[model samples]
Target: MDKDASGPKVVVGVDGSESSYAALRWAVRYAGLVGGTVDAVSVWELPGRYGWSAPAVDMDVDEEEARRRMRQELTDVLGTDAAESVRTHVVHGNPADVLLRAAEGAEVLVVGSRGRGGFARVLLGSVGQHVAQHAGCPVVIVRSGPS
Candidate 1:
Protein backbone atom coordinates (compact mmCIF):
# COMPACT_ATOMS: atom_id res chain seq x y z
CA MET A 1 0.00 0.00 0.00
CA ASP A 2 1.20 3.49 -0.83
CA LYS A 3 1.21 5.62 2.27
CA ASP A 4 1.09 9.35 1.88
CA ALA A 5 1.82 11.90 4.53
CA SER A 6 0.02 14.58 2.57
CA GLY A 7 -3.54 13.45 3.39
CA PRO A 8 -5.94 10.55 3.32
CA LYS A 9 -6.75 8.84 0.08
CA VAL A 10 -10.37 8.90 -1.08
CA VAL A 11 -11.61 6.05 -3.23
CA VAL A 12 -14.69 6.44 -5.39
CA GLY A 13 -16.40 3.77 -7.47
CA VAL A 14 -17.27 5.16 -10.90
CA ASP A 15 -19.03 3.41 -13.78
CA GLY A 16 -19.83 6.22 -16.19
CA SER A 17 -23.41 6.45 -14.92
CA GLU A 18 -25.08 9.59 -13.73
CA SER A 19 -25.22 8.33 -10.17
CA SER A 20 -21.62 7.21 -10.19
CA TYR A 21 -20.65 10.53 -11.66
CA ALA A 22 -22.43 12.23 -8.81
CA ALA A 23 -20.49 10.14 -6.35
CA LEU A 24 -17.25 10.99 -8.10
CA ARG A 25 -18.07 14.65 -7.89
CA TRP A 26 -18.81 14.37 -4.23
CA ALA A 27 -15.57 12.51 -3.63
CA VAL A 28 -13.52 15.14 -5.42
CA ARG A 29 -15.05 17.95 -3.39
CA TYR A 30 -14.53 16.05 -0.18
CA ALA A 31 -10.93 15.24 -1.06
CA GLY A 32 -10.23 18.86 -1.91
CA LEU A 33 -11.60 20.00 1.39
CA VAL A 34 -9.54 17.45 3.30
CA GLY A 35 -6.34 17.98 1.30
CA GLY A 36 -6.44 14.45 -0.06
CA THR A 37 -6.24 12.78 -3.44
CA VAL A 38 -9.06 10.93 -5.18
CA ASP A 39 -8.72 7.51 -6.73
CA ALA A 40 -11.50 6.92 -9.26
CA VAL A 41 -12.06 3.25 -9.93
CA SER A 42 -14.08 1.49 -12.62
CA VAL A 43 -14.51 -2.26 -12.53
CA TRP A 44 -15.56 -4.31 -15.55
CA GLU A 45 -17.10 -7.67 -14.83
CA LEU A 46 -17.64 -10.51 -17.23
CA PRO A 47 -21.16 -11.94 -17.28
CA GLY A 48 -21.13 -15.03 -15.05
CA ARG A 49 -24.21 -16.72 -16.47
CA TYR A 50 -22.80 -16.79 -19.98
CA GLY A 51 -20.93 -20.03 -19.35
CA TRP A 52 -18.01 -21.15 -21.51
CA SER A 53 -20.01 -21.01 -24.73
CA ALA A 54 -20.50 -17.28 -24.63
CA PRO A 55 -18.54 -15.58 -27.35
CA ALA A 56 -15.93 -13.27 -25.92
CA VAL A 57 -16.39 -9.62 -26.64
CA ASP A 58 -13.58 -7.09 -26.42
CA MET A 59 -13.31 -7.34 -22.70
CA ASP A 60 -9.84 -5.81 -22.68
CA VAL A 61 -11.05 -2.49 -24.02
CA ASP A 62 -8.24 0.00 -23.56
CA GLU A 63 -7.90 1.26 -20.01
CA GLU A 64 -6.79 4.63 -21.28
CA GLU A 65 -10.02 4.95 -23.23
CA ALA A 66 -12.05 4.29 -20.15
CA ARG A 67 -9.99 6.77 -18.13
CA ARG A 68 -10.24 9.38 -20.85
CA ARG A 69 -13.99 9.05 -21.03
CA MET A 70 -14.34 9.22 -17.29
CA ARG A 71 -12.12 12.26 -17.08
CA GLN A 72 -14.05 13.97 -19.84
CA GLU A 73 -17.38 13.32 -18.18
CA LEU A 74 -16.11 14.54 -14.83
CA THR A 75 -14.55 17.58 -16.42
CA ASP A 76 -17.90 18.48 -17.92
CA VAL A 77 -19.51 18.39 -14.52
CA LEU A 78 -16.86 19.71 -12.12
CA GLY A 79 -14.19 21.46 -14.22
CA THR A 80 -10.68 20.49 -15.42
CA ASP A 81 -8.95 20.56 -12.05
CA ALA A 82 -11.53 18.22 -10.59
CA ALA A 83 -10.81 15.75 -13.36
CA GLU A 84 -7.06 16.18 -12.94
CA SER A 85 -7.12 15.42 -9.22
CA VAL A 86 -8.58 12.00 -10.00
CA ARG A 87 -6.26 9.07 -10.62
CA THR A 88 -8.06 6.52 -12.76
CA HIS A 89 -8.09 2.77 -12.27
CA VAL A 90 -9.61 0.06 -14.47
CA VAL A 91 -9.86 -3.40 -13.03
CA HIS A 92 -11.53 -6.65 -14.10
CA GLY A 93 -13.63 -8.40 -11.49
CA ASN A 94 -16.93 -8.21 -9.68
CA PRO A 95 -17.56 -4.55 -9.02
CA ALA A 96 -18.26 -5.05 -5.36
CA ASP A 97 -15.22 -7.19 -4.72
CA VAL A 98 -12.93 -4.91 -6.66
CA LEU A 99 -14.21 -1.85 -4.87
CA LEU A 100 -13.95 -3.46 -1.47
CA ARG A 101 -10.35 -4.43 -2.16
CA ALA A 102 -9.54 -0.94 -3.33
CA ALA A 103 -11.12 0.59 -0.26
CA GLU A 104 -8.79 -1.28 2.06
CA GLY A 105 -6.44 1.62 2.75
CA ALA A 106 -8.71 4.46 1.80
CA GLU A 107 -9.95 6.98 4.30
CA VAL A 108 -13.38 7.02 2.68
CA LEU A 109 -15.18 4.96 0.06
CA VAL A 110 -17.83 6.63 -2.06
CA VAL A 111 -20.34 4.96 -4.33
CA GLY A 112 -23.58 5.80 -6.05
CA SER A 113 -26.94 4.49 -4.92
CA ARG A 114 -27.96 3.32 -8.40
CA GLY A 115 -25.99 3.00 -11.60
CA ARG A 116 -26.54 2.27 -15.28
CA GLY A 117 -28.82 -0.67 -14.77
CA GLY A 118 -31.48 -1.92 -17.08
CA PHE A 119 -34.01 -1.97 -14.28
CA ALA A 120 -34.88 1.61 -13.55
CA ARG A 121 -36.83 0.89 -10.39
CA VAL A 122 -33.99 -0.87 -8.60
CA LEU A 123 -33.42 1.38 -5.60
CA LEU A 124 -29.86 0.27 -5.01
CA GLY A 125 -27.69 -1.66 -7.43
CA SER A 126 -25.82 -4.76 -6.32
CA VAL A 127 -22.42 -3.07 -6.33
CA GLY A 128 -23.61 -0.16 -4.20
CA GLN A 129 -25.25 -2.44 -1.67
CA HIS A 130 -22.21 -4.69 -1.44
CA VAL A 131 -19.79 -1.82 -0.97
CA ALA A 132 -21.98 -0.22 1.65
CA GLN A 133 -22.00 -3.46 3.57
CA HIS A 134 -18.39 -4.59 3.19
CA ALA A 135 -16.08 -1.66 2.70
CA GLY A 136 -13.43 -1.52 5.40
CA CYS A 137 -13.43 2.25 5.68
CA PRO A 138 -16.20 4.80 5.92
CA VAL A 139 -18.63 4.63 3.00
CA VAL A 140 -20.76 7.38 1.58
CA ILE A 141 -23.56 6.38 -0.76
CA VAL A 142 -24.52 9.34 -2.89
CA ARG A 143 -28.16 9.24 -3.88
CA SER A 144 -29.93 11.37 -6.44
CA GLY A 145 -31.63 13.81 -4.13
CA PRO A 146 -31.17 17.04 -2.24
CA SER A 147 -27.98 16.94 -0.25
Candidate 2:
Protein backbone atom coordinates (compact mmCIF):
# COMPACT_ATOMS: atom_id res chain seq x y z
CA MET A 1 0.00 0.00 0.00
CA ASP A 2 2.95 2.31 -0.59
CA LYS A 3 2.62 5.34 -2.79
CA ASP A 4 6.13 5.39 -4.23
CA ALA A 5 5.86 1.93 -5.72
CA SER A 6 5.66 1.40 -9.49
CA GLY A 7 1.84 1.14 -9.27
CA PRO A 8 -0.33 -0.69 -6.87
CA LYS A 9 -0.74 -4.38 -7.52
CA VAL A 10 -4.20 -5.64 -6.66
CA VAL A 11 -5.13 -9.30 -6.65
CA VAL A 12 -8.73 -10.40 -7.07
CA GLY A 13 -10.38 -13.82 -6.88
CA VAL A 14 -13.02 -14.67 -9.46
CA ASP A 15 -15.30 -17.67 -10.05
CA GLY A 16 -17.71 -16.30 -12.70
CA SER A 17 -20.41 -15.54 -10.16
CA GLU A 18 -22.24 -12.23 -9.94
CA SER A 19 -20.46 -11.55 -6.67
CA SER A 20 -17.09 -12.29 -8.20
CA TYR A 21 -17.80 -9.98 -11.11
CA ALA A 22 -18.68 -7.26 -8.66
CA ALA A 23 -15.44 -7.88 -6.83
CA LEU A 24 -13.57 -7.60 -10.08
CA ARG A 25 -15.26 -4.31 -10.86
CA TRP A 26 -14.56 -3.01 -7.39
CA ALA A 27 -10.94 -4.02 -7.67
CA VAL A 28 -10.54 -2.31 -11.00
CA ARG A 29 -12.05 0.89 -9.64
CA TYR A 30 -9.73 0.71 -6.68
CA ALA A 31 -6.80 0.08 -9.00
CA GLY A 32 -7.68 3.20 -10.96
CA LEU A 33 -7.74 5.24 -7.79
CA VAL A 34 -4.48 3.78 -6.57
CA GLY A 35 -2.85 3.66 -10.02
CA GLY A 36 -2.12 -0.03 -10.12
CA THR A 37 -2.63 -3.27 -12.01
CA VAL A 38 -5.00 -6.09 -11.20
CA ASP A 39 -4.39 -9.78 -11.31
CA ALA A 40 -7.64 -11.67 -11.80
CA VAL A 41 -7.38 -15.21 -10.54
CA SER A 42 -9.83 -17.99 -11.38
CA VAL A 43 -9.52 -21.43 -9.88
CA TRP A 44 -10.90 -24.83 -10.88
CA GLU A 45 -10.40 -28.42 -9.87
CA LEU A 46 -11.59 -31.94 -10.48
CA PRO A 47 -14.83 -32.96 -8.84
CA GLY A 48 -14.38 -34.32 -5.33
CA ARG A 49 -15.78 -37.69 -6.38
CA TYR A 50 -13.25 -38.11 -9.16
CA GLY A 51 -10.44 -39.48 -7.03
CA TRP A 52 -12.58 -41.45 -4.58
CA SER A 53 -14.96 -43.06 -7.04
CA ALA A 54 -12.44 -44.39 -9.53
CA PRO A 55 -8.69 -44.30 -9.27
CA ALA A 56 -8.14 -46.34 -12.42
CA VAL A 57 -10.15 -44.16 -14.75
CA ASP A 58 -8.23 -41.24 -16.19
CA MET A 59 -10.30 -38.11 -16.14
CA ASP A 60 -9.53 -35.74 -18.98
CA VAL A 61 -9.35 -32.17 -17.82
CA ASP A 62 -8.27 -29.52 -20.28
CA GLU A 63 -6.35 -26.95 -18.27
CA GLU A 64 -5.78 -24.77 -21.29
CA GLU A 65 -9.48 -24.72 -21.99
CA ALA A 66 -10.14 -23.55 -18.46
CA ARG A 67 -7.56 -20.81 -18.87
CA ARG A 68 -9.15 -19.74 -22.12
CA ARG A 69 -12.53 -19.51 -20.46
CA MET A 70 -11.06 -17.40 -17.67
CA ARG A 71 -9.43 -15.07 -20.15
CA GLN A 72 -12.73 -14.68 -21.94
CA GLU A 73 -14.55 -13.93 -18.72
CA LEU A 74 -11.95 -11.37 -17.75
CA THR A 75 -12.30 -9.71 -21.09
CA ASP A 76 -16.07 -9.83 -20.95
CA VAL A 77 -16.07 -8.10 -17.61
CA LEU A 78 -13.10 -5.74 -17.90
CA GLY A 79 -13.52 -5.21 -21.64
CA THR A 80 -10.63 -5.06 -24.16
CA ASP A 81 -8.71 -2.68 -21.99
CA ALA A 82 -7.99 -5.58 -19.67
CA ALA A 83 -4.82 -6.24 -21.58
CA GLU A 84 -3.44 -2.96 -20.38
CA SER A 85 -3.61 -3.31 -16.63
CA VAL A 86 -5.31 -6.63 -15.94
CA ARG A 87 -3.78 -10.11 -16.02
CA THR A 88 -6.00 -13.16 -15.66
CA HIS A 89 -4.84 -16.57 -14.54
CA VAL A 90 -6.71 -19.88 -14.35
CA VAL A 91 -5.10 -22.00 -11.67
CA HIS A 92 -5.78 -25.55 -10.61
CA GLY A 93 -5.80 -25.57 -6.82
CA ASN A 94 -7.59 -24.28 -3.78
CA PRO A 95 -8.98 -20.83 -4.49
CA ALA A 96 -7.88 -19.41 -1.15
CA ASP A 97 -4.36 -20.75 -1.43
CA VAL A 98 -3.92 -19.55 -4.99
CA LEU A 99 -5.21 -16.09 -4.15
CA LEU A 100 -3.05 -15.87 -1.06
CA ARG A 101 -0.01 -16.77 -3.12
CA ALA A 102 -0.94 -14.30 -5.86
CA ALA A 103 -1.32 -11.53 -3.33
CA GLU A 104 2.12 -12.10 -1.88
CA GLY A 105 3.42 -8.63 -2.65
CA ALA A 106 0.13 -7.10 -3.64
CA GLU A 107 -1.36 -4.16 -1.88
CA VAL A 108 -4.60 -5.96 -1.20
CA LEU A 109 -6.72 -8.96 -2.14
CA VAL A 110 -10.33 -8.70 -3.24
CA VAL A 111 -13.01 -11.36 -3.37
CA GLY A 112 -16.74 -11.86 -3.48
CA SER A 113 -18.65 -12.65 -0.36
CA ARG A 114 -19.89 -15.78 -2.05
CA GLY A 115 -19.00 -17.99 -5.02
CA ARG A 116 -20.46 -20.90 -6.98
CA GLY A 117 -19.96 -23.38 -4.23
CA GLY A 118 -22.46 -26.09 -3.27
CA PHE A 119 -23.14 -24.35 0.01
CA ALA A 120 -25.24 -21.67 -1.55
CA ARG A 121 -27.24 -21.18 1.63
CA VAL A 122 -24.19 -19.77 3.38
CA LEU A 123 -23.49 -16.05 3.53
CA LEU A 124 -19.79 -16.29 2.66
CA GLY A 125 -17.94 -18.87 0.62
CA SER A 126 -15.22 -20.83 2.35
CA VAL A 127 -12.56 -19.48 0.03
CA GLY A 128 -13.40 -15.90 0.90
CA GLN A 129 -13.42 -16.68 4.57
CA HIS A 130 -10.04 -18.36 4.31
CA VAL A 131 -8.47 -15.48 2.46
CA ALA A 132 -9.98 -12.87 4.70
CA GLN A 133 -8.69 -14.64 7.74
CA HIS A 134 -5.27 -15.69 6.49
CA ALA A 135 -4.12 -13.38 3.77
CA GLY A 136 -0.94 -11.36 4.20
CA CYS A 137 -2.49 -8.15 2.94
CA PRO A 138 -5.83 -6.50 3.29
CA VAL A 139 -8.94 -8.31 2.04
CA VAL A 140 -11.98 -6.72 0.51
CA ILE A 141 -15.19 -8.71 0.25
CA VAL A 142 -17.63 -7.35 -2.28
CA ARG A 143 -21.19 -8.55 -2.31
CA SER A 144 -23.16 -9.05 -5.52
CA GLY A 145 -24.21 -5.93 -7.31
CA PRO A 146 -27.78 -4.92 -7.94
CA SER A 147 -29.74 -7.41 -9.97
Best-matching candidate per lDDT = 2
lDDT of 1 by residue, 1-147 (tens): 234535889998888777887898899889989999888888876664235467655554677787678778778867887687777788877788888898888899999988888977888888888888888899999976643
Q: What is the TM-score of each candidate against the true structure?
A: 0.84, 0.84
Report the lDDT tens digits of candidate 2 across residue range 1-147: 122337878988989898999999999999999988888888876656334464444478788888788877877887878544677777877678888898888899999999987886778888899999999999999999566
Compute the lDDT for candidate 2. Answer: 0.83
Clash tally for model 2: 0
In candidate 1, stretches whose alpha carbon ends up further than 4 angstroms from where it belongs are 1-5, 49-60
Q: Model 2: which ten-residue window has the lowest total lDDT? A: 49-58
Return model 1's CA RMSD, one decimal.
2.9
- State the C-alpha lDDT per candidate: 0.81, 0.83
